[model samples]
Target chain A: AQRVTQPEKLLSVFKGAPVELKCNYSYSGSPELFWYVQYSRQRLQLLLRHISRESIKGFTADLNKGETSFHLKKPFAQEEDSAMYYCALPPFLNAGNNRKLIWGLGTSLAVNP
Target chain B: NAGVTQTPKFRILKIGQSMTLQCTQDMNHNYMYWYRQDPGMGLKLIYYSVGAGITDKGEVPNGYNVSRSTTEDFPLRLELAAPSQTSVYFCASSYSLGGNEKLFFGSGTQLSVL
Candidate 1:
C-alpha cells in the first residue's frame, strides 16, 4: 500500500521563473524520499535526497510529513534544467529485509528561454 | 569508471525468442538492480542482487530471470519474449543500503518484441 504520486506529467516555465514539482507519498512510517532526473539520451541520476538537505543544480526539495509530500523546488529556472524528474521511495521491506525502490510516474519540466 | 554498463543498446525479438541483457558495473557496488521503464509508467523493479549469488525478485519479475555470479556482473534473461516484455531496461548499482544510498544507472537497453 506504499505509493508515490507525481500529479504533473509536464510543466513549463520561463527562464528565471520559480518552479515547483509536486510529489506525494502514502506510507505508514517515516519515509525517505529522493529526486531523480533524466536528461535526453542520458542515464538517470540522483539529483537530491530529502535527508541531505542540500540543493543540487539550484534545486531543493523539502519533505513535509503532515501532508506526506516531498516537493522539489528551484528559485530560478534554466533552459538546461529541462528534463524528466521523478520522485522515489525505497521499496517496501519484505520479510527477508530486501527492499526495492518505488518510483513516481515523473514530471517533464520544460524551461523555455 | 563505467559505473554501470548494459549491452545491446537496442534489440528486436520475435515472440517465443529468447535473449539476455548484459549488465556490468566497475564501482565494486554490492547492491545491483534491474528495472524496466515503460511510457508513462516510470520504472518498475524486475530483480535485484544484494551480492554475489544472492538474487531476489522485485515488483515485476515474471518472464525474466537474473544471475549474479560475480559482483561486477548481473545479467537478465528473457525467455519466450512477448509483446508485454518490450521496454527500456536499465541496470543500476549502489554501494550501501537504506534510503541514503545513491544508485548509479547504466545507459539502458531498448528492447522490442514483435
Candidate 2:
C-alpha cells in the first residue's frame, strides 16, 4: 500500500522567513507526487506536481526518491501564503489506470506578520 | 464552465436520517471521485468511478453508497447519518488521457449530523 506521511500538523513562520513543509512517502514502485493547497473556505487546488518540476506561487517541491520525500518549499513566506498544505501520492503502477490518490494528514501553515 | 458542481452546499442531518450529495462534471471526464475532509486530516477518498456504471470503494466508504448512472453525474448516499460523518464532502473529476490527471474539485458540501 502507498502511504504519505506529513509529520507536522501545524507550522508557523514569520513573514519573509523561509518555509518548508515536510512530506515523506512509502511506496514500492516509482512515485508520482503532488502538492495540493486549500485556502480558508476555498476549494482544494493543485499547487504543483513532481512530473512538471515547476514552481507555483513561489513554492517548489522536488521529488527525492532516495529519501522517499517530497517537501514543499518557499524562500520567503507571505501572509497570504498561509493555508493547509497536503501531499499526495498516487500508486505509481496505477497512475493512469486510477484516479485514487493517497493523501497526507496535511499541515496547517500560519505565516505570521 | 462550472467545472465540477456539488449541490446542497450545507445540510444538517439527524441521527438515522438519509441524504444524497449530488455531483456533476461538465468537462466530460471519465473519472470522478468522492472525498471527505476532516480537520487535521487530508481529503480521504470515499468512492471513485472510472466511468459510467463502474464504481469502486476507496479508502473510506463506510456508511456511504454511490451510484454512477452516467458519465456526468455521481451521487453519494449516506444512510443513518452519524456525528462522525459530519465533515466537508468534496466531489472531484479528472481525465486520464493526455496526462490530465489533476483533480478538479467542487466547492464542497458541508454536512453536519446532529
Candidate 3:
C-alpha cells in the first residue's frame, strides 16, 4: 500500500525564521514526490517536485531515500509563504490503468510577523 | 487561460439529494481527476478519466460517479448525498502521467450537506 503522511497539521513560525514541513511516504518502488501549496483565494499549484531538483519561491525539498522522507524547507519564512501545503506521490503502475495520487493530510503553515 | 474551471463554487444539499459537480478544462489535457478534501485529511481520489469516454474508479469512488464525454469536460455526480460527503472538491487536469507533468487545479467547489 502506498501512503503519504504529513505529521504536522499546523506549523507556525515567526517571519525570518527557518521553516520545515515534514513529509514521509511508503512505497515499494521509486517514488515521485511533490509539494503543493494553496494560498488564500488562489488555486492549488505545484510548489516543487523532487524530480526537478529545482527550488521554487525559495522553497526546496530533498528526497531522502534512507529516511523515506521528502521534507519541504525554507531558509527564511515570509508572510506570503503561509498557506496550506500538501505532499503527494503520483500513482505508479496500478492494476487498473487508473493512475491516482496519494496525498498527505496537508500542513497549514502560518508565518507571523 | 481559465486552465481548469469548476462550477458551483459552493453548494448546499440535503441528505439523499443528488447533484452533479461540473468541471471543464481548456488546456487539452488528456487526464482529468476529481478529489475531495476533508478537514485535516488529504485529498482523496474519487474518479479519473484518461480521455474522452474513458472513466475509472479511484481510491474512494463509492457514492460517486463521473463521466467524460469530451476532452474538455469531466463531471462528478454525487448520488444520495451524505454528510460524510461534505468537503471541498477539486478538479484537476494533467497532460500525462510522467514525472515531469504537473497538475493544474481549479479554484475548488465547497459542498456542504445538511
Candidate 4:
C-alpha cells in the first residue's frame, strides 16, 4: 500500500515570508505526486503536480525520488494563499486502473498580514 | 459545466435513520468517487466506480454502500446512520486515460448524526 505523510498539521507564516509544506511518501515504484488546495467554504482544487513540473500560483514542488519527498514551496507567502494543503499520491498500477489517491492529513496554512 | 454536484449541502439524521447522498457529474468522467473527510484524517475513500455498473469498495467502505447505474450519477447510501458517520462527504470525478489523473470535487455534503 502507498502512504503519504505530511508532518505539519498547521503552519503559520507572516506575509512575504517563505513557505514550505513538507510531504513524504512510501512507495517503491515511481509515483505521481500532487498538491491540492481547499479554500474556506470552497471545493478542493489541484494546485500542481510533480509530473507536470509546472508552478501554479507561485508555488512549486520538486520530486525527490532518493528521499521520496515532494515538498511544496513558495518564496513569498501571501494572505490570499492561506488555505488547507493536501499532498496526494496514487498507486502504481491496479487491475481496473482505478488510480485512487492516497492522501496526506493536510496542512493548514495561515498567512498572517 | 457543473463539474460535480452533490445534493443536500447539509443534513441531520437521527440514529438508525437511512439516507442517500446524491452525486452527479456533467463532465462524463469515467471514474467517480465518494470520500469522507474528518478532522485530521484527510479524505478516506468509501466507494468508487470505474464506469456505469462497475463499483468497488475503497479504504473505508464498511458503513457505506454505493451503486453506479449510470456514468454520471454515483450516490452513496447509509443503511443506518450512526454518530461515527457524522462528517463531510465529498463526491469527485476524474477522466483517467492512463495518465494526467486529476480529480474534480463537489462542494461537499455535511451530514450530522445525533
Supply DockQ values for each candidate.
0.66, 0.50, 0.64, 0.62
lDDT of 1 by residue, B84-113 (tens): 999999999999876457899999999999
lDDT accuracy of residue A95 in candidate 1: 29
Specify the highest-TM-score model's number: 4
Q: On a 0 to 100 scale, what is the lDDT of residue A86 in model 1?
A: 95
Model 4: per-residue lDDT, tens digit, A71-94? 999999999999999999877675
For candidate 1, the per-residue lDDT at B64 reads 97
Candidate with maximal lDDT? 4
Sorted into a CAPRI-style docking class, model 1 comes out as medium
lDDT of 1 by residue, A68-110 (tens): 9999999999999999999998754552335567789999999
Assess the local accuracy of residue A98 in candidate 4 as a C-alpha lDDT between 0 and 100.
48
* TM-score of every candidate's chain A: 0.94, 0.94, 0.96, 0.94
Two-chain DockQ for model 3: 0.64
Residue-level lDDT tens digits of model 2 in B1-114 = 889999999999998999999999999999999999998777888999999999998889999999999999999999889999999999999988322379899999999999
Overall lDDT per candidate, in order of appearance: 0.92, 0.91, 0.91, 0.93
Off by over 4 Å in 4: A94-98, B97-100
Predicted complex 4: CAPRI docking category: medium
Structural RMSD, model 1 = 1.5
Chain B alone: TM-score in each candidate? 0.98, 0.96, 0.96, 0.96
